[model samples]
Target: MKPSSFLSLARFGLKTILFRKTDPILGTIIVTDRCNLKCRHCSVNNITSVLYPYAQIRDEMHKLYDMGVRILFFCGGETFLWRDGDRNLRDLVTEAKDMGFLIVNVVTNGTFPIDLPEADLILLSLDGARERHDLVRGPTFDVIMENVQNATADNICFYMAINRLNKDAVREVCILARETKNVRAVSFNFHTPYPDTRELALSKEEKKACCAVIADMMKEGAPVFNLKSAFPYLIENSFPTPCRQCVVMENGRLSVCGRCIDVPGLCAECGYFFVAEYTLLFRGKPKVVFEMLRTYLKYV
Candidate 1:
């Protein structure tokens, strides 16, 4: 992260914390919902399979920028699959940076070639060890690792969503992130237990066990890109819901916190670590603020 970008974000954090502001500092633009892999735990893929156009996405970028979203994420069905005419996902990322987004990230399942070197972080999903990940996301673990090995830049971060099938493999992923060539760190979220994937949701005891393992990994010098300060709140689900500092824009519509905001009763059980981190930080939690600075500076 550049010093200027860091300073600007710090200013936003200060103002938000001081005033209890509801404005968003982070925004996610869902470029398309047409994903190639249908994971067992995902319900957001391929509903319409529409890859939104470049012009419309550009307009949405401007809208998010105008709304004070400095941290931008390009998400998708499969972000790499998006192309309008001759332009690809790389174009959208470069465009976002050129449009003055301080930090731009692209999320992918790592099923395709990765060439987005300009992105601040390429969040690639690597759910678990080969057997467990293949079970959840199909037989693509080796392919993802191969792509990671051959990636053009060292900006990849493994993104893992832990559930019943993959809960035991946390240390496996932490070790991989530490040793992997192009990977920077690993980020985690517990399964959110959407209506269809309720069976995969972890019990509170299970969540506590996961957090304990993550903390142990952090102590052992594994590059886990999350705050240990928020672990307690996350395990208990006591953090605020619908983080006001984050927003999501899909197609032309806007949603707060996440795309699943509309699902009834989902906020109370939110498993997204970011939502807990940002909400607690903006609500003036001193530990969350301090640890956020340390964690982000170290990994992002």
Candidate 2:
């Protein structure tokens, strides 16, 4: 809505129109699969189980950058767990920035506290209020809370995954985000049931209910990080869907389709929010365009 954001929208529009073949728009790199906490909703099966070497990580970034990627998100089975020499996640951010990435992002579980990379954003995977959070993610709520508060000086985002256990805590979490200093915004996602975690998946009805609540909160000025077009996908359980080409892993394995999708046929009930967001954007929704621009401007 502001002039600077408007200019950002213009820039995004022009670049998207002109740079069709330059590079992938977003690249998610997982540094490791070893996690400290065995979350009930996560399947630890068939992970690479090793930290990717620092050299390989550098080379991979170069490859993605040469292809024209401007955004890279550092993902992990616990990215903070990954280590190479004295290098850590923060180092990855510094290096990625040097490589000319427009912005770098990190997603972490918040178990092991460490200084983060100078990334444009850091998304802490928070599920709910303390009790519910502890139930779903183990007794690490205090730790995550402490770390999140400590990391406020940096631009950081909180990602809350709504499930049956944490559904009641939505309002509280929203208030927490709003009241807390150094908290940029909060994004809500429904639980995506990977093989060993199907029970954590919310029912279709529950998903609708949560989406309605979130929509109401947005109208009241509660800061939520969801595109306007993508909002409906969360609400109605029906909308345009995107085909994810592939997600490359640290071990050089490309988990294209079957790998990312939970095995034994639970993909239908899966709730990865980005699928819908990307779908609506690629479908050319005007609101999605504006939301993307707003996010980019927040960083630029």
The local distance difference test score of each candidate is 0.94, 0.70
Clashes of each: 1, 0
Over 1-300, each residue of candidate 1 has an lDDT whose tens digit, in order, gives: 999999999999999988878999999999999999999999999999999999999999999999999999999889999999999999999999999999999999999988889999999999898999999999999999999999999999999999999999999999999999999999999999899999999999999999999999999999998989999999999999989889999989999889999999989988999999999999989999999999889877
Write one digit per residue (lDDT tens) for candidate 2, span 185-241: 788778767756677777777877787777777788777777656766665656543
List candidate 1 stretches off by more than 4 Å. Answer: none
Error of 2 at 173 (Å): 1.4
lDDT of 2: 0.70
Weakest lDDT window of 10 consecutive positions for candidate 2: 240-249
